[model samples]
Target: MLWETSPNSTCLHAQREAFIADVNRIQADAELANARAQLRLPSSRSLVASTKEGKFVAMTSPARLAVSVLVISGCRRHEPAPPLIRPVQTTVIRYGTAGEPVSLSGLVQAQNQTSLAFRIGGRLIDRRVSVGDTVSPGQLVARIESQDAKNTLSSAEADLASAQATLVQARSNEARYRSLLSTDVIPREKYEDAQRQLAAAQSRVAAAMASVRTARDNVGYTDLHSNVAGAVTAKGAEPGEVVQAGQMVLQVAQKGGKDAVFNVPATLMRQSPKPPPVSVALADDPTITAMGHVREVSPQADPATGTYVVKVGLDNPPDTMRLGSTVIGSVTLSPQPVASIPGTALIQIDGKPAVWVVDPATSAVVAQPVNVVRYDSASVIISSGLKNGDVIVTAGVHALRPGQQVKLSPPAT
Candidate 1:
């Protein structure tokens, strides 16, 4: 029953069966590789296949080959990242045609502050006014113990009474001696002696009168009075404290004008003798503002702070600008052509001031030495370091070195 099979047909069937087996093997290998990939395992670089002619050939799938290359390369050490290029804010230098304005902290004060004190020294018995109490002209502000003063007055009055009695007796004796002399009942020498006694008594009476007046004044001085209408700003003495003559008992701020007081540096005080008007405003609330002019400056600097006291008289200040209130004062110097820069841009080099200047062509920063005329809170006046067109890095100056490369921030929108 075995029919003779054709040789060509046998060969063809064998080839077809082998090809189908190879295709199935390839599919299985692909599945295994996909599963390994899902499990995050390494995949083989190539697969082996048997051709119909019974020869083995190497085959690499495009997806698996790409993944294998990536994995191998990733395992290798990475090169270091590029150096960081920092960005910085910058400003173009410009010279001020007008003088720069300077601002300082100040305090509101009374333009005419007068210290109320006793003309005579005594123990303070009663203080009629406390701090911040309103007072009027000739108002009694305080009083000292007047017992001693009254005793002194009583003694002066007794001396005056005695002198007056002696004067009356002397006048009577002189008149009686004159009448006796006219009637030849007494000698001329006696009348002259009576007249001389009367003169001496009159002189004693005059001196006693002066003593009484002085005592009266001392008694009146025991009660301290305010010469001007104002408010009591301070108290230097309390009840039961012994105070000296001319010692401050109460500080009264007169009702007329107000002043903004500031402590200015000696360098600033050496400028123009007469400065321009100052703008004063409340420290917490700037909306409450006023204008003022320099009314007085201390002839000598303070020994503690080495600063001069400057008083600026305000023009019609608001009621809320009371004495002792904190305020801000601003003064503009006379116009001069000077260059100034932000304080942040200024850096120190070898104990001298310098700045980071940007090169327009290379965008590199270089430390250029600068001569600073003065330094303020927000700015520095340049005497000879920077020019009008020089560009300087305003921020992050401390982080940079000479010849460092930097990127400029875009100008503010």
Candidate 2:
């Protein structure tokens, strides 16, 4: 090609060579820049080595290198820790019988308590029984001063006697007057006057008889007697104390049946369809238990306590069961189908009661709304939203999230 080549062709060849040379030069300059950058930057291994030595012998200043190394280490350390799977205790829910038994504190009392008082007012003269004294039917409990009663009775008797004498005389006069009128020995007006006198005398006699009876009754009332076999619980009068009619002088508790009296909430009374059977235990002696049944329930709620007074009659109460002793009554209700779980399993979501339900296949938890029937001391009774064989997170419920994987811990020993 060089042998006798044209000038134009030679010039084109020289231009092509110059273009190739410029491209080579540019490429070489880029490579050199890249090398310089690599030398200035600190590698991971080199930085670690520099940290161990507490100094950097590389082209870069030690301060810059140290800062870069710390930043890189911080990034590596802060890289989001792998999400941890929490281990939680769980329980398998099953449908079973559940009921709320209302327990109440009550006092043991006699079924019949009587307050004895005088039917007539007078000064109390004698008290035959003291508090805690056992008494029998017809036993004298107390007596009022009877001197005034005796005097009144005597006056009534005297008046009755005088009235009887007058009545006898009047009868005799009436017989005589009738005879005289028939025989025409006296005027008709005289006979009529005699009949009127007899009638007035008969009225007086009748009045006197009534007064006598009333006086006798008043005398009898001065003596107070026990109507039932019982023990005296209280005494309101002492000798020489003036008492009013119908004022309570003593309180007697009858000896037969005992009752456990409780003030129960009105809500409990409404919820129970019928009076539930109860078991009573003495607060002082818990070992002493007796069976009982509801005897009475107040129709109206007490305004002060907002409760109803309930009386449970004890069956064959023991001798040791005394009046005024404290007792605890426990009642059991009919069984209902419900799911029972520990209280820890319950959680609230969106201001509503909920529970965490675990998916058996994926071991993940999801919040589920539940109808809570009852909240007991240690457990909760669920009425709806779960069925038999449902696994629930009984523990670690507060630290759970929706659709979070978990591992079931071993059951507690």
Candidate 3:
């Protein structure tokens, strides 16, 4: 260092040293900035940086944010989630003190139904009435051919006339014979013969008279008459059709009384109390209702339908309720204690019949299995698994779950 050196070499050495010192100073500054960042605590709004693929991503929350940086340098964001609240409808179930009424579909029919037929065999030459035609008592409804009948009557009349003439001649001979016997002008045997002849002729006349009356009656049998005032319900024979004796020709429904005929189950028939009052209503017009009583119940059940035939007699039924009209009959039975709920409230949970019961305090629902006693058109009778004063979800049952919170809507007025 004491040795004298060239000016150019000295200048080059100084420049190299200065460059080394500047590199050290930059290194030290980078270290100091990293240390300061590590010492500071993270705040709520602090930004966290993560490296994914080859790019950096910044997120607000470390626990909730999932950052996935694209290899091509892009960002994707997701919005916050909202709370879940379901709206539903509920109903308060109560036990029915008045038992459920049984309703059955039936047909309105005349109480007196008769089948009209001919008494004698003949060709049906005329039919005066058709189905639904009104007829009165002693009204001629139909007639058969009268040619043969008339001929028979004529022959009987001629026989009767001949017998009458013979009888008169015989009586005259008997009188003459009796006068001769009294005067001893005729033998006793001859008088007895004359008396026998008169007796035989009188018997012949009596027999002929009976034949004539029978012939007259036979002729009358060719005509068909209605014995009651009614409407024809059916026609079995047509004009010019030959029908046998006692063959049904028409069906007439007599006027005066109406009956509601219903086919009821055997259980209902057995359980029905004595003198149960039945109420009947027209299927089309329910407002036209009539009070009636049980008229007749079939002792046997129908094999095909397994139901008993029941006839209910209407008291003073209106004329508007025509024959063969559809009707509905309702009968009230003895009161029974049973829990009843709407059919809509029924559901299936865990492969069992169930309903949703709501907790009043928590407004949560739980699926409760129930013993179904009977199912009706709009309601159901529960035998067990349910009690009175229990709140049940009637509507929106399919969208509910156990322990799920719900907001109930106001009940319908």
Candidate 4:
């Protein structure tokens, strides 16, 4: 005898309530702080506990009354969502009309990429960020050996003070000499010399001020910093390494980094599709999504490539992408008529682009493969497909092959 399967008469939601309560009690007994906890809905399903692994540690999933029991490290917890009853299938279909816009391929670049270096040559005494280190604007990068710079600054300050003192003394001497000359107690030449000394002292003071400026500038150079917020793509010199003025020390990619290039066909350009927005899937991490923008479009097209070069700029490039990562992305830009059809309507015949055309008169879809010029959001631009007023199977197109009979009504309506 064969047993027929049917939906359970009982709702799992009511039964699971008691099970959930029991799980909660166990969690409380474990003394795990109820950090970010939630009960799974009846329709949803989940184990009592789950574990997540990180760079340094791992947390095991807790067991539920229905499933397996587990031990976990007491640390942090995730903001849990309502549990899912069963695994759900997920798919993403991106469709767009062809458009034209600029494209750039690059790592996440700072708006203003800058390299911090010393104003004067010195040994690097400290470095705050290494390659792949993220830094904020005005954050320190490194400091140069500044003992010499400080000494020079100190000496200039002392000279300035001494010159001022000399100026005062010279003025006093001049005044006394003038009085003597007027009274005929001293020769006129001596009075002139005293006046000259006063003038010299003033010049020395001005010179000292210039020296101070130089010294102050030198002191500032001893400390290097990033001018903009971004990750350190490269390092110039290590700590204790000597660097000279104007020497390149580091390379940084500005946020919204490098450009993505695309070579599109000239015929497609005529359609004038909107430029494709860009995103990146890094070689190191294909799962993480990144945002980017089209930055450039070359008017000229290369016949050999049968396309024009378009560039895109990426935002928030991961460390892997920060140092110039290779990535591939789509540029959805085309000019054509839009259509919304079931995914089943698409068919390829004779290794050429084609689609099935459904005729309302006969209630039949005929294979009429046409050139798939480009894709629009939720539709496709067919330059040589079916004409206006032509309809085709939107659903279950895959089930029917070429020259196969199709029924008007199916059981799974």
Which candidate has the top score in TM-score?
A: 1
Residue pairs that clash (backbone atoms under 3 angstroms), model 2 = none
Summing lDDT over every window of 10 consecutive residues in candidate 3, give the lowest-scoring window: 67-76
How much does each candidate deviate from the true structure in C-alpha RMSD? 15.8, 14.6, 17.7, 31.8
lDDT (C-alpha) at residue 354 in model 4: 62
lDDT by residue (tens digit), candidate 2, 1-413: 22123235555455445446645654554455444445765343222223353343333346644654453333332346776688999888788775667568999888999999999999999999989999898988899988888899899989999998998998899899899999999999988888898999899999999999999999999999988889888899898999999999989999889999999876567556486879999887889999999998888889999999999999998878788889999986566677778999999999988999989899899999998866777988777989788888989998999999899875432
- TM-score preference between candidates 2 and 3, better one: 2
Span of ten consecutive residues with least summed lDDT in model 4: 1-10
lDDT per prediction? 0.83, 0.81, 0.81, 0.60
Model 4, residue 256: displacement in angstroms? 7.2
Residue 118 accuracy (lDDT) in model 3: 89
In candidate 3, stretches whose alpha carbon ends up further than 4 angstroms from where it belongs are: 1-97, 185-187, 336-413
**CA displacement after TM-score superposition, residue 312 of candidate 2 (Å):** 1.3
Best-to-worst order by TM-score is 1, 2, 3, 4
* Tens-place lDDT digits, model 1, residues 292-324: 999998998999999999999999999999889
Question: Once superposed on the true structure, which residue ranges of model 1 sit more than 4 Å away at CA?
Answer: 1-92, 183-187, 266-275, 349-351, 356-369, 390-413
lDDT against true structure, model 4: 0.60
